[model samples]
Target chain A: MSMIKTDKLIYEYAKLDDEGNVIGTNRAIDAVDLEVEPGQFVAILGHNGSGKSTLAKQLNAILTPTEGTVWVAGRNTKEPENIWDVRQSAGMVFQNPDNQIIGTVVEEDVGFGPENLGVPTDEIWTRVEESLKKVGMIEYRHHSPNKLSGGQKQRVAIAGVIAMRPQCIVLDEPTAMLDPNGRKEVLRTVEELRKKEKVTVILITHYMEEVVGADRVIVMDKGSIVMEGSPKRIFSRVEELKKYRLDVPQATLLAYELQKKGVKLPDGILSTEELVEALCQLN
Target chain B: MSIKLENINYVYSEGTAYRKQALKDVSIEIPHGQFVGIIGHTGSGKSTLIQHLNGLIKATDGVYYFNGENVYADGYNMKSLRNQVGLVFQYPEHQLFEIDVLSDVCFGPKNQGLSKEECEKRAREALEAVGFPGKFYSQSPFDLSGGQKRRVAIAGVLAMRPKVLVLDEPTAGLDPAGRDEILDQIAKLHKESGMTVILVSHSMEDIAKYVDRIIVMNQGSKLFDGTPKEVFSHYKELENVGLAAPQVTYIMHALKERGFRVDTSVTTIDEAVEEIAKVL
Candidate 1:
């Protein structure tokens, strides 16, 4: 069964006049459809104004869609009674680690989510340990979050969501702020979580390289799913992605250019090794 | 022109209930005009170490010397050191409050007590330095895109005309293109401005492409200090410290695991291609 399903979702920001008067509305999302199977790792990609973030917000019910419905684990998010349920069902990790962190210490911060759900003290600690270990942050559990690097902080945040034991987790540009090392740390942690915990993963990011590892890639532009395919399939179409103002993986772009210039390399070369292997095959 | 930290230790809220040891006997030196990247798992004292560089946080047990002069020594005047070593923090947009881009960029220079004309000139120059158009001076800083807001924030620091510029996660909220643009601008600024630049980032590819040196932090201790190639060459060590090399490096290493003999230390795609071309 699909873990997440969205149908014809629409959202609009309210346009206002200078005097707090009501003006028209500006559409952010048009008709959109999306689905994610259980244990799938999905990546959402787009430019800054492309409504990708808006769609993510909808999944968590941070913003209710203007039209259509979203179902998380067969529960409709649009239903008023299930807002908290939806939030718990689909946890979100935002781009900025500083803003999302609430507690002073790493383990305490991870415990916050489960604590809010009224989980008992013993269970919270257990969840905290398991989650921290999952992200490989157990060693720093007693340390304060402020002293952590951006990537470490992000891992702690992800552990916090995992502690909730949610069925799905949605990250909105989670690694956007981290350095090269931090970005790798957080992405590796996320990938590991999907493998070990069997939790559904939704990662919103602009880095094409990151999407290469995802099970599926969803493209958003003007609040719609413009492209949906495996990373290889999506990257294979270099021209279509470029028209959406999105950059493919660097190697993919280079390979595409080489192919255009009449190299016999195969399409959708997402990594340097793949490109090299393909070129080695030529002649 | 290098900045050195000798046995630096810092504890937040020294006497309060919230007292926390952020750094512990840390010692490292950033050579002049060198592009150094600082990486660590969270709570590894990376932020605290960088703050001490410009005297934003005075070390409790060590010394900070800018060009071998004690910046925290008696009568040395930390205010001047701050001007010489400017910091652009993560989400630097929080520092922006002015009505327009020009006034905001001028804040640092104006606070330095430069003449009004000098402040204006520096603001314009700094804006251009970050690649913002001259016409953007009149636009409200809040009116620009997230990437533009970030540039304006960096420009604010640049207006100070510091010899050393430090950024803490400068590309946090930017899109991929914006990420590329900002990193490229920092590289260009380093080359064109010849300023000492220290970047704190989480993307290995970013540091691999721009930084001249890499500094690894874990548990609030300086673990590795060397060039990108040298630092990333210890990918296993980095992973043990809760880090990984760039994707290209990872792929290269994976190929090596599968019995291929290509070098894995190549940092950039262009270089990776060149290395692979020679072997393949």
Candidate 2:
């Protein structure tokens, strides 16, 4: 069974007038179908207002679909009884680490989720230590979150989610507010967590480089899935991605430009090493 | 006309257990009409340094001169200084709170004691400068998209007619095209108005493409200050400080290591492509 499945999901919010009356409806998420198997790493790429975030919201039932259905861990998100089960099955991390972290101390923050889930006191501490260790933040367990760097705070945020022990994790532009090193830290931690815990990973981001390592990539535009394939296959269509207001990784773009200039380079070079290898092979 | 900071030092929570120095003996000079990029890791004092520009945060020990006038002089008007040195904070869209985009932009100039018509006129000009569509002028800022809201926020600052515009991660949450559009408009603004632009950003690629000069900050001190090609030549050292040169720099360096006769100092894609083509 799939860890997450959306069947023609459609989410619409009413366009309100000055007096707060609904004038019409704005389709934020149009009819779309998506499926993610357990332990798979998926990346969703889109511009702001492209409905990628709306689709992520549907995974944990933050916003139930206006039409169609979303299933997490074989449970329907729309069903009120299954809401807890769906949420427990899929953890979410947001863009701003400052907004997501609540507890003062690092370990306390990581234990917040499981504590709310009614986990016993002893197990909460155990889960807290284990999750902190997994995210490489165990040393900062007693430190104040306010003093931590952006990358450290974000890793603590991930540790909080990990303590929930969800079958899947959905990160909505988690690295948007971080610096280059911070972004690298969060991505490495996500990759490491995915391997160790076998949790399904769905990352939504605007950074093209961050998606290069994903097993699959989904391109969203105008509230619909416009393209879907492996990262290399999707990046090969650089012109199409640009049409949707998205970009290929820098290396891929450089290769494409070189190809256009009549240089015999392969399509979809995803990294500097790959591009260097391709260029060195020429002549 | 220029901005100068000499021996600037900023310490947070003085005499307390959490006392820490955010900026240490940083001295730099930025001339008028120069587009400068400041690159640094988070908590490296990038924000604190920009905050000092518009007198938002006063340095504990430093001398600041703005256009030949001492900003820290007794009885100097900080309000006028702020008007001349506009600072746009990160995630600027969150700062937008006016009922409509036009009025939101007008707030800054209006606060400067300008007449209502003058305020609106400046607001309109600023909006147009940012390439914001006229159709969205009357719409609520809350109704606009993230990119559009960010533009309106920038317009609010630009409406004040500042001589030196400072933006802190203006493209933090924007998409690729949106980022390019904003940066290009800023570049155009710099070209046409000749106003100094101090852009603090994390993306080395954007910095290399737009800015004429780059300043690298680490551990609250100026680590490097030079042209894009010069600063990026120290890509290895930059990586040690949790920052990096643009991807093209790495690609060029790797190609050079592979015995290809390529210029490792190439920062932008265009330069890399041209250099690689020349070598091939």
The model with the greatest TM-score is: 2
Q: Per-residue lDDT tens digits of candidate 1, residues B1-280?
A: 6898899888989999888888887888877888889988767788888888788778888888899898877899788889999898878998799989999998888899999999999999888888998877898887687888999999999999999999998886677777888888889989987889999877777888899899988877788889999999999988887777876777677656665677888777777666555554
Error of 1 at B255 (Å): 5.1
Poorest stretch of ten by lDDT in candidate 2 chain A: A274-283
Q: What is the DockQ of each candidate?
A: 0.27, 0.85
For model 1 chain A, the run of ten residues with the poorest summed lDDT:
A254-263
Q: Across residues B40-95, which tens digit of lDDT does each residue of candidate 2 receive?
A: 99999999999999999999999999988889999999998998999999988888
Q: Which stretches of candidate 2 lie over 4 Å from their true place?
A: none
Interface RMSD (Cα, Å) for model 2: 0.8
Model 1 docking tier (incorrect/acceptable/medium/high): acceptable
At residue B8, candidate 2 shows an lDDT of 98
After superposing candidate 1, which stretches have Cα over 4 Å from the reference?
A1-3, A16-19, A37-39, A67-79, A82-85, A97-167, A177-199, A238-245, A248-263, A271-283, B6-31, B251-264
